[model samples]
Target: MTPAPIDIPDEIRAQVYVHALAAFPAECCGYLVGARAGVVDAVVACTNAQDQGAHPTHPERGADTGFVIAGAELLAFARAFDGDRPPRVVYHSHTNGRAYFSSVDQDLASGPAYPVQHLVVGVADGRVTEAALFAWSDNAYVEVARWQGPREGGSTA
Candidate 1:
């Protein structure tokens, strides 16, 4: 069965958006470390590690359409976490456009690496157009929630 969707506050959403905007023209990826309780306590930016040209796996595809979280950095991040608070989400932005997960994303997320949620941000013109939460379940990636921005009545954006 699929898990319930995460309820993210507007402030946290804004932070991620800012990161994506700042990295415009280049996809930005990172890990969200926290409890399984589904609250994002921190957004740690990870190097995309995608070489601009001639990626080992798909030289033709190039780095513009891919991202790699350096294994060494990942190891150090896990070591620093103390095992109590583990990564709850893996997030990245589609710098050029489109919010949907690509086949490459599926191949990467399929590892069941951490069973954490996956968040994709849609960026265009240095602004976020759409963003959503996804999770790997059963044998595929499932959409969990779409960001609705701030709530009404001056909830803050």
Candidate 2:
């Protein structure tokens, strides 16, 4: 059965926006940790290892179009499932200002290397524009929630 939608608090969402903006022009990747099953309480910012030319499958692509969590961060993330506060959502940014899972994303998440949902942030012009949360359902990942970023000269409400 499909799992219930994970809950991301506003502050946590804001933190993600910040990470996305800070990595503008390049994709930022990270995960959300929760003490329980359905609600995330913290955001763990991770380095985007794509630009390091170490991405196992797509090293030719730069961070502008891809992201990979590797090395120490990856080890920690994998080990967290056995901890008290495990990650419930893995998040990444799209510098092209679109918040949909891409073909590469599908390939990486096919076997769902981890037991977590996905949050894709859309960023352009150095600011976050939109974000979408997806969860594995049936044989694919599907959108479960969405959040709109602050408009130009406006606030996030």
Candidate 3:
């Protein structure tokens, strides 16, 4: 089966880029909104649970960054908005290189621990270079959409 498509708005893309750049040399993290055939709206700042490297040799890898969203935090965020909506997207950033879901990212993506879409941001040379979104289907990871800024093109699949 094909994975659902997602549309990331231009404004959120800019913010994701800024956040990723600010956390350069270290992994940055955040969350995404929207699911199925809906408009992707809002990008929330999230904690980088893995502040340090999982291994001694790779200290800058945010792929190993285990992300957790506290219920209280979600509840607080939920109350501010009107109507009923589920927090169905999770995001994070890579301090260096392109945006691709790492092994650790895949594991987390497919895990039942969080029922949401996964978004990854890549920061390189003091800029937000890449962005990719993914969703799990049939026990595997599938691409959703990607960010396209003035520097690079966007991907939506």
Candidate 4:
């Protein structure tokens, strides 16, 4: 059976958008940490680390176009929570296209290794355009929720 979808608070949602917008030319990378039942109370904006070679899977995408949580930084983030509040979601933005889980996202997520909701914020031409939340279940990545922002030259999907 499928698990129930997570309900992200409006404040958290707005923060994600703001982070995405701030990242702009590069992808924004971060985590949502909280104590409640999947309602994120805080947003932690982590280093992109893409230029830092955090991910070897897709070097072509580099820092300006890609994102990585990084090794030491991931551990740091884990320690940052330290049983007080667990990581509820791993969030990043697609700076060049629409929000969807790319192959790189899958490799980074690693089939339940980084088990949590994965949120992708889409930014194109320097505008916050869309968002989607993906969850892993039954050994596959599936979208659990979605949100679209006002798009340039198009309608919100």
Candidate 5:
């Protein structure tokens, strides 16, 4: 069965997309945990710095950097929620390209670690091309739905 579409307010979507883009050259990853009804309850920005050997280390090519969400940070985020809204989705941005879940992303999310949705935002050439949403099920990342929020930086062009 197909999943319901995910929706984000224009303003919030723009902000999230911009944040992902701003962290260019390095993977920008974060969490958006909130209650449903097509609105965001809280958007928590997680650190992408790999320090605990969780993320793949690549030669700093000054272009792409591996994204890592530390264990402590994840735990802290969960504790912070305390069953309030609960983690609804994990979000990340792809700099220098479009928003599509790579194999690495799938591998990382494929487990009981997180039983929620994943949002990938792709930014390219000053244009936010696409945003894809996935859910971890049956030992794989299944494409649930796609979303479009709003434009940022006030470009009428």
Candidate 6:
């Protein structure tokens, strides 16, 4: 059965927006850790190895349009599931001001390689404009929750 949507606290959401802004013009990738199912309490920012020519199939693409979590970070993510606080959501940012899963995202998540939801942050002009959380349902990932606004004093944007 499909699982319920994961819960990301406002402060955690703000942290994600900050990460997105910090990586502005380049997509940022990471994951959210939770003590139990359906809730996330921490955000672990990972390196976007896209520009480093680390993307398996599309190394030519820049981080501004793509992102890939590789090397040690990827290994850590893999090992997290066996820990007490596993990741519940994997998140990334889009340089364009739009928070929707792209074809590349679909391809990477086809098998869901990991048992986690996805959060996409839409950042443009060095600020977060919107964000969306997606979960696998039916035969595809669908948006389960969304937020909008700019970064200011720990808010859900």
- lDDT digits (tens) for residues 11-37 of candidate 5: 666677777767654556787766744
Q: Candidate 3, residues 106-133: lDDT per residue as tens digits? A: 7765664556667778776677767888
lDDT of each: 0.72, 0.82, 0.66, 0.75, 0.65, 0.82
Candidate with better TM-score, 4 vs 6: 6
Model 3, stretches more than 4 Å misplaced? 34-37, 52-58, 62-83, 152-157
- Rank all candidate structures by their lDDT, best first, as comma-separated numbers: 2, 6, 4, 1, 3, 5
How would you encode candidate 4's per-residue C-alpha lDDT over 6-123 as one tens digit per residue? Answer: 6778788789888888866667899888884757788988888775543456533543344677788788776765576778788888866588888777766766765478888887
lDDT tens string, model 6, 22-130? 9766678999998976568999999988755544354224433556889999999989999999988999988767899888888888677778899999887777889
Off by over 4 Å in 2: 1-3, 54-65, 155-157
Q: Which 10 consecutive positions of candidate 4 have the poorest summed lDDT?
A: 57-66
Global lDDT for candidate 4? Answer: 0.75
Candidate 1 least-lDDT 10 residues:
54-63
How many pairs of residues collide in each model? Answer: 0, 0, 0, 0, 2, 0
Question: What does candidate 6 score on TM?
Answer: 0.85
Q: Positional deviation of 32 in candidate 3, in angstroms?
A: 2.4
lDDT per residue, candidate 2, 1-157, as tens digits? 7556798998999999998898766678999999866679899999988755544464224333556899999999999999999988999998778788887887787677678899999887788878999889877888888888777766545
Give the worst 10-residue stretch by lDDT in candidate 2: 55-64
- What is the clash count of model 1? 0
lDDT of 6: 0.82
Model 3 residue 110 CA deviation (Å) reads 1.9
At residue 70, what lDDT does model 6 achieve?
92
Estimate the overall C-alpha local distance difference test score of candidate 1: 0.72
Per-residue error (Å), model 5, residue 79: 2.2
For model 4, name the residue pairs that clash.
none
Off by over 4 Å in 6: 1-3, 54-65, 151-157
